[model samples]
Target: MVTDPRPGQILALVGWSGSGKTTLLERVIPLLTARGLIVSTLKHAHHAVDPDQPGKDSYRHRIAGATETMLATRERFVLFREHRSADEPDLALLLSRMAPADLYLAEGFKSAPVAKLEIHRPSLGKPPLWPDWPGIIAVVTDAALPACPLPTLDLADPGAVAGFIATRLGLR
Candidate 1:
């Protein structure tokens, strides 16, 4: 279990592509929320990404050299910022922009120094990350890995994973 996480503890779901990181988060978020914990998520993309659509005012504004653009309505709002340079902001900088929540679930940023649950699928044929990464506190896998030293949980069971997270964060 985590000893003393920074305020609004951050946990990451990290794994290679097609290893079910996002899929687990999709299940875990609702479970966490239902338990009365406010949750926020941050996703990192390796490729250039734009949420705005072409021919739209927001997209046009961005294309016209606006460094930042925001589209807002009563229902929701999206803020898009352009990175002129290739350097992406680190996790700490990005977390500062988010509203306060009981927990933060990050989908990517696997290399960052944060507590993470490694999701593994044997069929993916990728080696487990915990062997080289100390930040990986536990693992969620669809297949057995007898060599892994950390606590292992079933990937198909989100409740068990959520409970583990809550327990580790000292929320339960």
Candidate 2:
């Protein structure tokens, strides 16, 4: 029944702390890209994130009240946006600022208005988010989820996870 994530839309890959979300994404992204998909990612941190070292010129610029700083080189560039308050930007605004891709993959935005693929590991001893969170399209788990209503995917098969996402996004 889940639909909204067509091509060029956002789909979140989310899980509790230490639930292998990053590890699974590390494996799955390559498979999706190998099949000729351009994926962009947005990672939400629960704690403070510092992209620059204290002594770096960009850091000094930010410390001197520069809200945005661009560090560029031949191969790539990085833009750092510094916030002085606790207000976290919403997913839509963050996604809009990113360059277009076939799919926008977000990590750890539990309340965002996007479809999600949940990574669940019962061994981690934490409660699953799917039962309470909305917009979970499927679950990738290492164990049985008898009570879950969504499609259950195997955690060991990153290819299958990639395929599911591709199919859901209508790109496969």
* Model 2: CA > 4 A from native: 1-8
- Poorly placed runs, candidate 1 (over 4 Å): 1-8
Candidate 1 matches the true fold with a TM-score of 0.93
Q: Which candidate tops lDDT?
A: 1
Backbone clashes counted, model 1 = 0
Q: Least accurate stretch of 10 residues (summed lDDT) in model 1?
A: 1-10
Clashing pairs in 2: none
Q: Give the per-residue Cα lDDT of candidate 1 at 143.
A: 91
What is model 2's C-alpha RMSD? Answer: 2.6
Local accuracy of candidate 1 as per-residue lDDT tens digits, 80-133: 888788689888878877788889899978888789999988898788899987
